[model samples]
Target chain A: MKSKTLVIAVREYLAAVKTKGFLVGLILMPLLMGGGVLVQSFTKGLEDPTPRTIAVLDRTPGETLWAALDTAAVKQNSGTQVLSVPKPRYTLKHIETPTDAAGLDKTRLDLSDRVRRGEVTAVVEIGPNALKPRPTTTPGTEPSEDTAEDSVYFSTNRPALLEVRDFVSRTIQTPVLAARLGQSRETIEAVSKSSRDVLASRGLARKTDTGVSFEPRSNEAATLLLPVAMVVVMLMVVLVGASPLTTNIIEEKQLRIAEVLVGSVTPFTLMLGKLLGGVATSLTLGAIYLGGAAVAARQLEVLDMLSVGLVIWFIVFTIVASMMYGALFVVAGAAATNVKEAQALMTPMMLVVVMPMFLIGPLMNEPHGTIGLAGTFFPLTAPLVTMMRLTTPPPISWWQPVAALLSSGLMTVALVWLAGRVFRAGFLLVGRPAKFRELIGWILKG
Target chain B: MDDAIAIEGVRKVFGDFVAVENLSLRVPAGKLCGFIGPNGSGKTTTLRLIMRIYAPDAGTVRVLGDSRHGPADDRVGYLPEERMLYKSMRVGEVLTYLSRLKGYKPNRIEIDQWLERLALPGVARRRVQTLSKGQTQKIQLIAVLIAKPKLVLLDEPFSGLDPVNSNVMRDAILELKNNGTTVLFSTHDMASAEELCDRIVMIYKGNKVMDGTINEIRAGHNTDTLRVRLANLASNFDNLPGVACAIAEGDHHELQLTPTADAQAILRELQQRGPVELFEIARPSLHDLFVRTVHEGAA
Candidate 1:
């Protein structure tokens, strides 16, 4: 029986690892996630030496705010090339006319041809009260009850257009503040230049205790994300990774292999073998995914924050969650009549496993607070919650996870026993799930 | 006794509906025993009970001297009526896995040898879903036989097989019996049952209706089948003195003899009209016995 179980486990592990779906997930998850981070770094890697083509639609007369706007973007260490033309090469361009009515008529005629035909980026109308918010309340009276914006209009579905609008608004708003100083253009320009330098110089001075903050973790810093990621992996291992394993068992039962195996071995053996096999299969897939993440992260710089020890946690939690869900899934898989029922069974179980993630705020607010401490202690929810706490800077005591590990070990045993009971009788069940007495009688004996 | 299988006074009731009631029977080692009955006559239910899939409500079962409910090391094999093999698994892998579960590591050479022996060598590496029903049944049979258990119980092993495959199965089963393995098969095909079974036990509606060797059963029932051909087309044997009834085929008439009379007298009279083409005496077959038994049970 022991040999058979081990054989079942090994066979299951190898078979799952060799499957196309598992292999794809194993190769693709790390590549996709790590690739996302890599893609970010690659996109971020492009140097900003070249000036940007800054297309502006300033409707204010004689470029009233252009000089001030150019200096503000320079303070942020980026360059801009100003473009103001009779007709810009984008949609939503303004066609200046002699009068407001004339302008409206011309815009009506040209808006379709220009904006719809992509002649300008946007129309910035500098009409009467164009850049001003008209006062809604008098100084001596109670405030009016309108809780809405003054006005701005643009075509729907162009979110990037807001960047252009807000830039112009900021460029114009700064001069309104500058008007009170009653300074000449040259004086305002000098002061703004001095202020921009002061801000840029201070930005470089903002790094405090950088070397010292990471120095304490220098020896074990390689693996800080390991503990946290392991917990996440633990949940994912059971929730997402066990899909095919459960499907394998369910398909067999549907195919009637349960009875065939029962004829060869004891029902108890079959139950245990299948559960262990599922666990082995799930863990094996997890290892491949973890390994891929490690390799892909090594090639790119960002993923190096996670350590080999994190991979170890992945193995441990994976084993724990695997057995836990493996036992659980065997019963569910046995009860389920088809793939849809099995999926329906798993969705709730998955939500239960991931519910702690939704409450991460409570747990992270105080890593050792009553709620966080209890979350760390509770076996079912601890793997994710405690590890979530560990990801931050509290330097959680080692005793916490040791205690959790013990409780989970004991919980796994209990769950396996209960699941074994369910698995043993559930395999023989046909039609719908039975009532209590009938279910119990199968376990007891006819 | 070291019987290959013995089910005694076994009763199984699902809720208020009894599936098997006080069923008792035995099969000696090294025999091909046919288990025959109608659809709801408890054949599959009895097989399930024998496999301990559903434990009997009362009484006990012993297979080859070991209790049926004992651990799996007991030398026994089962092929269920409903087929099940891993669809995605390579044939060799699945067979090896199942064989390992049955307490043996199947060698590829031996597995291939068996597959070739069963004329399924082409499917050894292919997935099970790609195989035809006959091919899959062949694989299933090989899987059950790979361990070479002392006893093998098959439920409708020939249900969906075409005639050729059915013949192959019959031959394999006879070979197993010759190899000293006790075989019990439940089937609805009475012709196969008649040709294959060494002994039989018939049940209906959760009760054993008849139990015996084929000859004993034929002798007990009023279903004697005669091999009598008419001497002339003008002759009518229905009104003959000793003939109870007669059924005519293309060139022959089957006559049933009256209990108190001799069939030789009728044969002599039929010989007078013209020379008889053929005449022979044979007992009624299991099909005839089955029909008579069912009619008697209803009566």
Candidate 2:
């Protein structure tokens, strides 16, 4: 036969999971987190896509100009390729103009008409001496003048015009340099690769028994955001999981169900069942988020950098924290007559639960800081703050986590004991919620 | 085990307020006992002590052979004054869940049968919040009795029920008694107690005022009042011999005679004066005795 506590736990779990709020929270929380990650990744390396059409009057007197335009398009498209963003393909229109100064000026004057007619997003004019080196310049010497030589640009869209100007500049410069150096493409690539110095940056890794494993360092701060965010998520689950206990207890009291329940089971049994149910709820939510995070981490190829031990600690800490907070809420609920009174009684406990969220930054920055140690050793904040510290770069002593876990467990048990006493005393009470003095009186009398 | 419950000098106090004081009562096994008292008269406090919802500060209480406090027995079932079950849970689910907490297996068939018996078969899958007041009361009553407990304690069970629903609840209590379950319900409604209780216990200001069978309590009170109905006559019947006072009661007149007065003489004189349609000496009712006893105890 199952114990009565298990029955109550199962009933409480079923009651909560059957609600529409549960289903919505279960599905939407992960989707929201995934959406955040996707938004960051998409916005990282690419600018917003705006359509552009370029009219290039390349007066450089050769059919090879088409080849230069193709190369520049490929180079411009390659900028977005590394980030996996879709390239905003631009239409390249070649303008037929005489190589004389008068004809060039006439074409430049017509650029605004073409833009007004919507024939192109922008017009770029190239002079006949656009790629011709001046007699004062030699190979390997810095070109004092730009190759596009006083090119007149016209556009209605500013962003599109900037992109077109960049494409046109690169289209003229690469070919002019190659012609001036008289070098083949293979030789230029080889020389550039040999002379380039790539400076790679990495974050300091936690020193394990074996060796240090460094995490890839990027200018993006999101790499450090994941662990701290996990702490916040776990804290959020703890708070969410424990909220129902207060309302449920006070509701049962106001509805008089607690009278019937107390007649059939011990107050301790009822409290134990409720605490177990809360832990189960928190764990269920944690599992959904953890699974979603795992899928996301794997997709982002950061799965290897994630610590399995930290996740395990997250599960343990969430259960302990939820039980501790759930017990306190139950006690507060039993002391009150209604939801409003219950919330009033729970104000102090709510503050305690919120303390760790504020300390997240300090703990993430210095896992062994004084604030981190205080949070880890203090029974109220230990489970959350300690779990956060374990995921940060600075590795804590093994004894710290073990000590935090043991202390949190003891504190949870003590709180449950106190809750049972409060419940027995106030389950049948009505009219007004107990004052702090009365609650203390109950505990001391017990 | 002749008595399902036995309390002796049970005293409970909240802060400085004595909710129940030196209150002792007993309910015979397989008997329906009405715990009668007016509002705020220690009725709820005493019932809670019986169910172990509140531990007595100064005495002993034994229910179903258990003396330990705090819901230590599975043989006791309680229906509190407030009838709030899980409002969102299905009717069957709530019943089954409550029964399981009482250490019984979930019985769908039994639950469905109960729903049908209560004329609520269609509500088996409905939420309790959607039910009418009477319907919710019936379901809560069922939850109390579903565990087949030996001792059932109901507080203010008939407070807000209509005549029809009140009859249903009255019959349900009697049915539990027939099943050999000890049923003790607290109520301020005296008529129901007079009609339904085999034994009644009355308390006032946390003090026991009366306890015994309803007939025994009524017989103990002075029964000198006479109820008479007659045709039109002189309105000076108040001046009749041996009649101390006459008060009109609906279609009849209740004449309270002095202790030294002769009731036979008064009836004869009234008959000689006018045509008397009805006249009878009335016994003291539970309501009358309750009012008299509580007043006397207060004095």
Q: In angstroms, how far off is B238's CA in candidate 1? A: 3.9
Candidate 1 clash pair list: A90-A119, A90-A120, A90-A121, A91-A120, A92-A122, A226-A310
Model 2: residue A372 alpha-carbon error in angstroms: 3.0
Model 2: which residue pairs collide?
Answer: none
lDDT, candidate 2, equals: 0.80
How many residue pairs in model 2 have overlapping backbones? 0
Tell me how far the alpha carbon of residue A40 in candidate 2 is from the true structure, in angstroms, after superposition.
5.4
Candidate 2 lDDT tens digits, A276-368? 888888888888788877787787667764578888889999999999999888888889998888877789889988888888778767778
Q: DockQ winner among the candidates?
A: 1
| Model 2 chain B poorest ten-residue lDDT run | B232-241
What 10-residue stretch in candidate 1 chain B is worst by lDDT? B66-75
Error of 2 at A277 (Å): 0.9
Chain B TM-score, all predictions listed? 0.91, 0.95
lDDT of 1 by residue, A1-446 (tens): 78877877777767776777766665555564457878887655243323222333334455444455556545533323223212111122224434465766566455544545555444443333233434566778986542212222334223455555565566655463354355555676677778785542111123356542222233243344444455555565555445565577677777888788877766667767666766776676677666765675566554635555545655676677667666667656666667777777778766766777766666545657888778778887766666666655546788887787777778878777776666666776655644556546644652
